[model samples]
Target: MQEVLDALEAPPIDPEARIALQRYYVRCEMLRKVDKRYSEDGRSRITLLVRTIIESEGNENALVEPVLVAVNSVLRPGWTGKGLAFIEAFDGFPFVTTLETMRGLNLFKEENLGQYLGMVLHNRLLSLLGPPEALSAEKPKRKPARPLRRAA
Candidate 1:
């Protein structure tokens, strides 16, 4: 977990690749929500979701809605002013660090502080990308051509 956080905090050599990785994370989360069976199979949910989304002819909006919902659900609690402040300071907070450090002490049988941090990061990335649209509604309409007129 420390390794992952350190890597994330480090400055990126390739900004584009970093952005792509962030998007990939969001996509994986979306896919996991769309299909619960992937979690049961112990396969790579991210890879499966990317492949499925790429190959399917279904509307993009259809695919994005569930992903948005999943991401939204996590952020819903943070909508309040106090929750928002906690979220903003989440990474650097002493309480957060204490919780993470305590995980090594084996207080809980199963600790998921790292997972929660990852989710928060994922939510932040998605928020920056703006809302996902499964289906774009900006198609241009074509006007009928006027009848050809003879030269005067």
Candidate 2:
């Protein structure tokens, strides 16, 4: 795990993105340490999800990692996290970070890491897209829904 922590130093990524990534790592650790109540056939849910993420690559029938997809959309669009290391894509475009400072960070205490990561990712997307006013201006007006006809 030290190696994973140390890996954060070489390629700088966004602070928020870094936090999300670390939180994910911490989550994986937590899942690893949790009891077997969550296990099925000797494998925990996290293990299954990680397997899916790895095995699903290039196969249309396999389940994709939705969280990874969202992370890529905000950090580096169209990136598949292929060839590059697990966290390398964060160094591109808008996302970039150090984990040393995480020791004192209170936000990590949240119970739901996934929700927290989503919030961070959303904020990063908003920042990159521009201010809220600009976003509102850019949004196209939606046409009103037409009434549906009764089959009878």
Candidate 3:
């Protein structure tokens, strides 16, 4: 609980609280986005009225929609390398130091703050590059094996 809370310090605001607010917003959008495909207003209203569930029934409180929107807007899909540097400053670190498990934080010094931020951002980049699965391109499906020909 604390870890999640602590990891949400988004700077300029209580990051945890902002996430709560964002979830509420997403719930509302899920009911009525511009597209017909996402129009769940009737069902959403009924579910809210009945069981009072405010989030996706079995989902992990997904941030994919927001993340994808941000990533696509800037990263333009298939854009790789350079890593998540653009987001590191707001990634629960900002003006603080991030402990190994992302479980700790400390105020940044006036002078050394930028250096520490660089280190943290660098580590994040390394982490992104280190995972081959993450870096690998989405593979196309393999064609069916060609039929064996008789040795004539």
Candidate 4:
């Protein structure tokens, strides 16, 4: 779903994010296979997602941590927690500290990780093509991302 949307809307896949996303996709499929194999053998849905996430991503600090923080922090419903490393790795792009930037990003969804990723290939596509008025000072103001209080 998000993949098509993001591809149509996004600029281009960041090199690092692209690699991680690919790994995630592969890992997810593999885990699904394992879970299905076990389930057919009469086992429950095994917790293969995490291991797959780690293996495809290399490590939390190397991959998932930063993306998680960015996703959690920027999305409509913000999120937070310790060892949230993806936030650091995804520092590839600035302004991502704000959720609105992500929504504005035009990315697609990809499979893997703690949750599904926005797989859209849209790069921070600057308005290279747009109405002349887009650059006007009269442009409407955008809503700011509100920060949630960290739980004690």
The best candidate in terms of TM-score: 4
| lDDT tens readout by residue for model 4, 36-140 | 532111011111222222332333232243353223222211111212432233334432333334445655233232232322211221122111122223456
Task: Locate the minimum summed-lDDT window of 10 residues in model 3.
Answer: 47-56
Q: Pick the candidate with the highest lDDT.
A: 1
User: Candidate 2 has which clashing residue pairs, if any?
Assistant: 13-96, 13-97, 14-95, 14-96
Q: How do the residues 58-91 of candidate 3 rate in per-residue lDDT, one tens digit apiece?
A: 2212222222122222221122333343333233
Q: Is candidate 2 or 4 superior in lDDT?
A: 2
Count of backbone clashes, every candidate in sequence:
3, 4, 0, 26
TM-score of 2: 0.25
lDDT for each residue of candidate 2 in 19-134, tens digit (9 for 90 to 100): 54445556545665684432222123223223323333332222222343344333322222232432332333221121213224655543334344545655654554432232
Using lDDT as the measure, name the better of candidate 1 and candidate 3: 1
Q: TM-score for each prediction?
A: 0.23, 0.25, 0.21, 0.26
* Backbone collision tally, model 2: 4
Cα displacement (Å) at residue 152, model 1? 63
What lDDT score goes with residue 96 in model 4?
32
Off by over 4 Å in 4: 1-8, 37-65, 68-95, 98-152
lDDT of each: 0.37, 0.37, 0.35, 0.33
Which TM-score value belongs to model 1?
A: 0.23
Candidate 3 ranges beyond 4 A from true positions? 1-109, 130-152
